[model samples]
Target: MRGEEMNFEPMMKMMSLSSIGLMIWIAAQTFTPPKEVVVYVEVPAPVVVTQVIHAPISTARPAPRPDSLCLALNIYHEARGEPLKGQVAVGQVTLNRAAVAYKGASSVCDTVFARKQFSWTHEDPRQPSGAELRPSLDLARKILAGRYIDRTHGALHYYNPHKVDAWWADSYAEVAVLGNHRFMR
Candidate 1:
């Protein structure tokens, strides 16, 4: 009986040793290190855009009246052989007349578009009165001061009699105002 029991113990020991060896082999195969790989890729360069710019405003101060006034004064003075002061005075008068355009009731509408009142002189009979004349006169004054001729091209008021005379009397109808009587006939 003792011998049989000892034989059984050795058999059990062999079985346990075989199971441990099988487990170690399985663990080693399952835990293999990951393989290393090398790859190449191409990338493109960045793109650029362009844009227009305007000139900066001038810092130099401007004269009170329009620059045209200065130019006209220069030309008039040079042509007639007059002093610069006379040219400047001419510009000033244009500004001044524009300022007090509605002094009289008849002159009130002096700057308006009424044809009947339209005269060769500053005093137009058909000129607007009171509030009606104010806005138009004010605008006219501004235009004159700015040296902007309302029409594309025309005589500067009735100041130059020569221009008025050169145009036919019937042509006066087309003009906003005829030149002063001296020029109109």
Candidate 2:
């Protein structure tokens, strides 16, 4: 009870209390679960989403493999047993337009010929007129090369002199071998 007296019992009790607290802490740590846990997972069914990307599509199809529009036309006409002279004349018209020192533009008119132009009227007898007068070099080249003869109705066809017929002409007489003046070797 004195101020200067040593408190042994109190000190002993405090030490005991601390030792009990330490024992409890150690026991809790010893019984603790592992640091990492394991789990099982399953994947669900695959999901497919269709996305459309914008790209240019050519409504026009591939044409024949002739080098000159005239030749292809001739081949087509000759194949059908039609007149070769007219086909060649058509080809010549194309070349003439191509060589026009006066027109100052390429004779090739297949690209810009409107639907209502002179060439669009198939039964008009003047199918080979105006811009359509020129033969398509692209058409000729296809005939010459002996490639696919598209002859499709729409944008693909040998431009008739004035007619816009979609019917395909044969390439027998018109399609001649290169430099041989003949369709086949």
Candidate 3:
């Protein structure tokens, strides 16, 4: 009977210890924080595109008229020796004179060829070679095309400063002095 009692006591202690351990494990599972779930979403990257448009190129220049030719000749004879700015000023003056309708002259050609207007026109003016007059010709084309700005500030007359003073210089107001010439309005 003593052996039986001792064996029963040890069995009861083992069962109690196992039951305590089981209760602790269950408490830990109930009290512990839950693990967080992470979700990932993929986004598409933005695409960039570039485009260039080309314009059609013109191969030939338009045919020049008699008035344009006359204006070119006048610029060639008048301001060819001067700087490009001076040539442009001369062209502007011619255009300005044409605008004024001076001495029954209505067009650019008429204004340029008007009696005693340009010194070169007093005589039969010789046509300059294309190679010699290329700069004046180009400038004239730009002026006729209305692509040039007036540098003379609305000047209608210009004269070489080295030359003798003319009676007309006193009548019109002096506007500008460009290169070797003085512009008057």
* Tens-digit lDDT track of model 1 for 52-106: 2122222233433433433233223222232433233333334433345533322
Model 2's C-alpha root-mean-square deviation from the true structure amounts to: 31.0
Cα lDDT for residue 58, model 2? 27
The lDDT values for all models are: 0.32, 0.34, 0.71
lDDT of 1: 0.32
Residue 2 accuracy (lDDT) in model 2: 19
Per-model TM-score versus the true fold: 0.20, 0.23, 0.63
lDDT per residue for candidate 3 within 1-185, as digits (tens), equals: 21111112333334444663464345334442233211111122232332222212222344667777888889988888888788888988999989888788879999999999999998877878878777777778899889988878999899986864676798889989888889998
Best-matching candidate per lDDT: 3
Superposed model 3: Cα runs more than 4 Å off: 1-63
**Residue runs of model 1 more than 4 Å from their true location after superposition:** 1-127, 147-150, 156-185
Q: Lowest summed lDDT over 10 consecutive residues: which window, candidate 2?
A: 36-45
